[model samples]
Target: MDHLPPHPGADAAESRVAARADAYAAAPLLGCLLREVARPVTDEPGVHLLPGCGKLLRVRGGRRPAAPEVRTAGGWHRLDHAELVKLVAEELRRHTGLSNHELPAEMADSRDTVAALLTARARATAPADPYLRSEQCLLTGHPHHPAPKARGGGPAATWLPYAPEAHARFPLTLLGVREDAVVEEGDCSALDALGAAPPGYRLLPAHPWQLDLAAAGLAGAFADGRLIRLGTTTCDTWPTAAIRTVYAPERDLFLKFSLDVRITNDIRRLWRHDLRKLIRTDTAVRAAFAALDGPAAWLSDRGYRTADFAFEELAVLVRDGLRGHLVPGATPYLAAGLVEGFDGSPLDGPADPAAWWEAYLGRLVPPVLAAFAGHGVVLEAHLQNCLIACDGDGVPVQALFRDAEGVKLPPGTDRAAGWERLVYCLVVNHLMELAEALAERHPGLDPWPAVRRELARHDLPEIPALLTAPTLPAKTNLLLRWTGADGAAAHYRPLPNPLAGA
Candidate 1:
């Protein structure tokens, strides 16, 4: 057979996809390096000096920076994603005086994962529901993390079917744990509604991906009759931005499971310690939200169920559904999703930018502050943990916070530590990202002033120091990963606070 010539159109399309993936992946990696370690040259625009290597690095664009180049003896050399990863690894080694083979590979894996997701997304149809669409729209996640999309450096085939970015949805793998082996806490009655459990077994729905990942460890339980496969859920559940959590609109329930994969900062497994403290943390948050006089709500992590043998691995948490908490005539969208943006995002083309931003701040800021000041419950109000509900006109009217596992309570966590955490999650992580996105979309919008005013309205003692502080604590994800720090242990670097002068 004669060899056929390669089609120019197809080749060009593939090249475009690769280039886009590179840009998408590079933005977060560059943002992390610049924010966490590099110092900018005051006189040179777009140029930053990597203090570790004493090298000048430059990038193009803000918000989502791109086109990374390093200054060499001969001149400047642009780097592809692979070269960028190598550069980052080398810089980190020099800066931290540590050699880490793992993080560099994760950085590469994250970029490769983006390429795969881009390709998969092109073939898949987007979810019709705007909420689900918003949840799945994060192509470039955690803008300051080195490996936001790294799925344990596994093959795409292993993770893509369950990936939110791919707009993928699948049924939960239903399993039945023997009555004696079943371990549960709090209200897990909603779980029984998923499917029927035979005579002496309790219905335990599991993430299929987790099952595959831990098959070897779970073999003894399966073989010993402690756990048995009971088929799958009748309705498909959409995976949220938090990949391990799945939402079933039909049942109006959220099921969080243990996935033995390193996503961003953690392994994403429901740790035993956190699981044990679920009820206490959730109760504190619930009481705080109930006492507050507003539309802000809390999606309680009602309870969790697991096999006694595989407590952490098989654990699945049941969270309160949306319908009951959301305001009438309002539609809920993930806060992180709003920043990432989707087809129906309210952030897109707002009629009145100032009014829109004010409404958003009104809905989001108060509950977080009240939860801390009034009730001593520090809610993790980071972007991923929050949901904003918009009315028919797409004006934000409500803010709902979830994930009791991330919440901090008094005594156990000192007041000062909890306050610092609240500021980081609510102000630095959540509001700052949203404000940047809004300001980027609408050039004249000065979101910090509204943030300053909204925060000032809150009478908390920390408010004054927060507003005038020269710098704010920003989590150092890149350095954390490089140093192999405990994923839950957060390290921070001071970032110039826009709130200071605003």
Candidate 2:
């Protein structure tokens, strides 16, 4: 790996962008103590590197040390770099309390230890999710503060706007800013509008590159709040925490907390809980599902991609379910936690198959269709969000709807925003997850087939039958079955995965 040390003060202008990347402690506190450590020369690796910030690693071979081979962030796999000079630069700053002028490359060879530790850390959190401990870089730029324009394209999605709730605590909007941009006491204030600032609440907007540095220390403190620090459905602000949220099995709720007062979608959805008909999208979606005449229940949620910190897409979090709330009639398994996908976490583990699900379709699908046909309100009656609950042991008792977020209604018939949302929430997103699980778990069970079969079994209308025609392509079939054949998109890739032999 190439090692170049440009003195900070001698070239502040040169260090502007690179400085934005605060020097960090290696993974494992000091990382593996190899020959040397490789530090980030520039922040915004993807953008800064032009074609994209790449993962540059410095590995030490037995006979020859490893050279830094750059790989694009899109699919770069390894980070075995050894000459991370920034770590030394950061330590100097912390020890001397100096700006670029203070950071000195001292005793120099702290690598063998830093590298080993860093590698261990990477392996520790490496599973479906990997652990990432990073340092920060001080950068230079014109930060919008509250509204940072999105990189590449798309409109700048400004979340965490000042709200009535933020009256007490100043609403801090994260800009694409660097270190110098942090004005002294920028967010330290008590607004005459908002009463007392919550004791533990504080806001500090840093450059997107700095979040890892912040997360290594602050994430612990943020978890202390009853409603601790909120994160954007988008990870652009901080990839570490964003990655954790997406992969954690615990957290299941997310919100963009949009700042634009006019862009009040999150607020509207949250407030809809008050209105009688739309008390909860969960409830509405549940009712809509129960209304459907089918053995298939809505499964996965579109909101739950288990979040990715790439920040390439909308980081908006649609609050659809309340975690921990239990449905008495539902199985405890039904009361299971939800993984907000890449973005959130509900309960834990999925509803138990042996302990929660009803017997086979022969007996189960019949009553389910009958229930919806009778009421015309399949409120989250799908297989995923809703539960096939039993009494004490593992006897399937009833189809209990747990996520009172989305309630379902018959298609073609438009209700209110609440109902339309219910259709989207239930039939589309929620059922879709369940359909995929069923397809994945019990291949030939035929979830959509069950949906249609249930409709015919009941006198309910055959509105969803358009999905099973032949001529459909393969990618569509995969995505459809993959997502559990949701309500609306069920039309896109009509062909179902073959359930024949297996």
Candidate 3:
């Protein structure tokens, strides 16, 4: 991590800046701690008992919990970011009977990365467009993940140039693969229109960061006549919240590239197995959406292209652009951005907070449940994968979903396991988080009742039990990272379900 210079001069100001980074970093870890590990002492909110450790932890409660403190013998010890990380590590060690050196380091790296981002953003200007600005405003991502902002422990210089939070944009490095060497499936013809290729080669665009990471392996291909460098795109492409996927406004296309760095739980490379199963998964989702009523849409993963030798390293997926799928006058906003917040967000100040919440639940919930119950297709309808389109009044009119790589179909996925995933993704991850954000903005407005009402409207047999269930399965992101578990293997801890009575 780069030791970013403090605000102008004043050593005092520098100390304050460092403290702010620590607080920003601590919030997510604290959320994970409270959700996954700690036990509540009383009905009183924000206070929890760290079992077997003989300690009490308290935080300012909300979607992004902050200002953590630990009760001690002498008095209450306020934890700075480093102290908090130490506390978490100690607690996990005592609780699990295992020590993980890497996660704690990642926790620190995440803090340092936040500090670097804050420094860079202070000098940078945010984009004027609300949608693009929303995509760039996720400074503290995945509210429940302990190390959401860590850049694979790489130097700031290596990753900062491509960071979405830094509001960075760069032209993709175009490559020409020998006709015989190119391997692709489905409709990758969209890639060819980006740039022209040589006589017997096909045009393939690669994320500059991916190219840098894979440069050593690609050297052999370049040495031989198998691959040719064709320079970069004519215009800059904006990276969405998912850093590997970029949006080209001029061409109205989305390109998802294979990145070697681990953003959150996974290496983030487009694996060969997932890419091979993509067409089948995407086709099923497309058919599900087609059968559904109303304007809800699926931004299909049209196809992908790559080199035969370096399949996963060079793979790039083409996704449907927003322009075609969006309703006539509505503006599409990334659902995750709406939760993380930017300058302009519908949830910021809804005309009728209750009505807005209803419309949101109405549009977003049905398709996910319908896809699961009716089509046997479980869509990863989490916030980042969803886009909610709102009209002039900031009322949600349409819902569009993307990313087929995360989709799971029948037989390949066990029935019980698939339902668990749907409930986790749709209710716990998506609705619950968005509801918290909305409720935080509009005090006294309970968004879960509307969520309950929306779920009740659907005829799936699971709906009744879901409404009466005492606990909801929340993903154990912090522990999963700590234990070095497979990213796709989700282990959950029970959380108090807000919709239990509703």
> Evaluated with lDDT, which candidate comes out highest?
1
Alpha carbon RMSD to native, model 3: 2.4
Q: For candidate 2, report its TM-score.
A: 0.30
Which 10 successive residues of model 1 have the least lDDT summed?
A: 6-15
Q: Superpose all Cα atoms of candidate 2 onto the true structure and report the RMSD in Å to 1 decimal.
A: 19.2
lDDT of 1 by residue, 1-502 (tens): 9988888698888888899889999999999999999998999999999988889999999788899999999999999999999888888989999999989888888989999999999999999999899899999999889999899998999999999999999999999999998899999999999898899999999999999999999999889888999999999999999999999999999999999999998999999999999998888888898899889999999999998899999999999999999999999999999898899999997899999999999999988888888888988899999999999999999999999998889888888888888888988899989999998999978999999999999898889999999998899999998998998887888989999989
lDDT against the true structure, each candidate: 0.92, 0.29, 0.89
Which one is best on TM-score? 1
Q: Score candidate 3 by lDDT.
A: 0.89
Comparison by TM-score, 1 against 3, better one: 1
TM for every model, in the order presented, reads 0.98, 0.30, 0.96
Q: Which ten residues in a row have the lowest lDDT in candidate 3?
A: 6-15
Candidate 2 per-residue lDDT, tens place, 3-101, comes to 778666646643432222222222211222121123434653321121122234433222112222334456443333233434333433443344442
Residue 141, candidate 2: Cα error in Å is: 35
> How many residue pairs in model 3 have overlapping backbones?
0
Clashes of 1: 0
